[model samples]
Target chain A: MSRQDAPPIYLDHAATTPVDPEVFATMKPYFTEHYGNPASIHTVGQKAIIAVDEAREQVADFLGCKTGEIIFTSGATESNNFVLKGVLAAAKIQKPHIITSTIEHPCILDTCQHLEKRGVEVTYLPVDKEGVLNTKSVQEAIKENTVLVTIIYANNEIGTIQPIAEIGEIIKKANQERKNKIIFHTDAVQAIQYLDCNVKKLGVDLLSLSGHKFYGPKGVGVLFVKEGTLIEKIQHGGHQEYNKRAGTLNVPGIVGLGKATELTSKNRVADSKKQQKLRDLLINSILKNIPDSHLNGSNKHRLPNNANIRFDKIEGESIMLHLDFEGIAVSTGSACTSGTLEPSHVLLAIGVAKEQAHGSIRFTLGKDTSEADIKKVLEVLPPIVKKLRQMSPLK
Target chain B: MDHFRDPHNMGSIKDPDGVGEVGNPSCGDIMKLYIKVGKNEAGKEKISDISFETMGCAAAIATSSMITDMALGKTLAEAIEITNQNIAEKLDGLPPTKMHCSNLAADALKKAIADYKSKNK
Candidate 1:
């Protein structure tokens, strides 16, 4: 019965996608007999070391970068911290400044906030009504002391895909005029699988990706450091990840991550089309049934799988619960801070009024989402919204 | 909540004296409670039957189910007094953030019982 209550529909891919079976299958052997410490020079260690090197090569190939540019970390959160800490530590005497956007992940936000306490000035560029930071905003925010600019490639909350190429160009032009050019970074945790995330074309000096965000295992991530980028290492320990990050390699997690990268590269186009259709269906149907609703981002520029809707007269959490009863799984942005009833910061960043922010719902499609699942969602959601609006105290 | 592991009083009730539908749709958690309230010949206001349906997180669903179990066969007045805190305590204390879910069940119960009393009187 409990299993029955666990609805088969899973539409919350942005929170964390399930590991592909193929990736898990590729990673299984390393858990036991094939396991060895990558650091040790012994045959056993060399075996693991060889696997690690091969995984790094695979990861680099997937990202269209050289092997040396990659640094494995716990996840994107750690990678963001590493980049911020590394640059801050190296540029101690310069009274460095950093620029980021209001829509950045908390990893970037909190890290910058921490840096502010430690004497670093941070310039927060604001996004437009659609949650997009224009290149002009970025260019205007850069200052003489600005050492770096960290922005999200795609917003996790509202699914706003930033104009990275344009933003990248603006920063490059800004850097050309300065002696200590500002480094460019983007947290593309949500862009790796869905969007074609090529670091060179994007011209980002540093980028962070959580493996789990792209259907790899949790606790494993990649920090893409462009060659010649000056960044400092925050953690001091055994020189793993080229002395850039410390502690023994998470060989098993790295293997899973590498496998996941390969699988995503292989299945990205086909799987994206599959999820996109479902996303469009959900968006269209919800708008049709719930008339007083609005789409949150530029339809053309958003992720294929992301469909954010604001149903007037209803709250997101209440809608979430109502749909949850109908055996559907969706999100309202940022599962990282789910327990908090506060509306999403990304929604607020995009200039969504607090009322509309409370009413928003994010339906992110994934590899396993089916048409039937979406049909079930459509079947049960409209009535729930109607009923909830009738009960809302705010109304 | 217990329902996640072993849900209690889950079947359809034969008859009901009061029913509770509480949970904020804006918050994405809801519970519907059906109660059978009447005197079993002894003039006691016993909740003769009870069942519930909930839409929310596992914790919320379980809390709703637990509250129904606690209120089944209970006196109507006694059932109305069950606080959200009491329902949460029954679950060995829910996660701090989900405390409102317990309140949802209790609040819905109060509404249902009051509805019942108003209609019968």
Candidate 2:
């Protein structure tokens, strides 16, 4: 388990993934040789436009949507904001309300907070102990002026997959009952790589995904806006992305995204099966070997690659650093605020005690992950957890 | 990181003269420090024994271990005078973000000394 034995065994894929080699090769030409602004009308620009168009088609095909429905943005944050704010601003009513979960990404929660200051009412629905949103709660929270309902398809920290299609059906039935059009949105950034993302079957009006999560380059994402959905332009600039989003195209990143999307879509089933086997092995071995440790999130209906574990009487950051010294990479379920680290809001919302939240560690697998990597982690982890626990106050 | 591997003055001291418990709210870490008092030949009070238990990041545990090692066998005044900077320096300087761990260690030692003084008085 020494650093010299092998390269670092990375398990933080949920944060961001390395670009696939094929994706990099596809994007290489666009960066150097075919550099041109899509807005420009010349041949080089037309070439760039052609690439962007084909990328759009690739992404659209992956999502089972038409090309015109996909709008490229900087990333999921921008896409989430555009959908939340755009729909609110364009609503016919004087005051618009939004419904989102308590465990959404900060982009959605922070954006809701920002809009609330400007005369919008937001309802943050709570999740069950297992981090699953109850459809009955969503059904009861709908109001006449509720213009948008945005929820994450899979939680980043816990890896719990929300019932998107069921929630969609509930929203559709509510709309039919009240005759009020409430748009459904899901941040599918974590789901696009592994889950089936048929927009029609999911019954979502808008879906957001980031390129980096799917082995594509950073700074590129797609916002699938169902046709005829009323959304105002958030950025006021050039007339791109059907006048909904304004920015010059990122030709190379988009090309990379296209290839990444295509590769992931084709290999998802086999890759997920492999990752699931490794994930379960790591989980079972750790739980059996390590004392006083339990898994976070639901055992079933979770992402194939995620394993969030909590060790009693030990802090996750210490475990992460100890693993880092062993040339293994993992993530802690805590974020810094005002120069002090705080447990993740997602963990807190799921009824994990504040102190227990400090002990949460997340290990997310990826396409490149192998069984040997999982074995290496299992070998290094038990001793680290034991050592940290020996020094802990609770123990 | 090495200090984390072989921490000094860790665990609890039975029948301690003074004990201080501290918590870092943001990180949700708890640290407890114990001190046993003794009088030297010069008739000055000294930290006869010191140990710590911490539940936190590497820096927090290291600082707790560092502070106890720094305080053991030192005069009560000297032990209480050890600052967060000294603890951080002993650990080869912690990340700026983890500086609070050193602060928590210093505060725990200071409170232990204060508890000893008040109880004796």
Overall lDDT per candidate, in order of appearance: 0.80, 0.89
A251-336: candidate 2 lDDT, tens digit per residue: 99999999998998899999999999999999999999998888888899799999999888788888898898888899987653
In CAPRI terms, model 1 is classed as: incorrect
lDDT of 2 by residue, B10-89 (tens): 88889889998888534567899999999988999999999998888777888888888899999998888899999898
lDDT at residue A178 of model 1 (Cα atoms): 79
The fraction of reference interface contacts (C-alpha pairs within 8 A across chains A and B) present in each candidate is: 0.10, 0.66
Q: DockQ of candidates 1 onward, in order? A: 0.11, 0.58
What is the lDDT for B75 in model 1?
A: 83
Query: Model 2 misses residue A27 by how many Å?
Result: 0.2
* lDDT for model 1: 0.80
Q: Using TM-score as the measure, which candidate wins?
A: 2
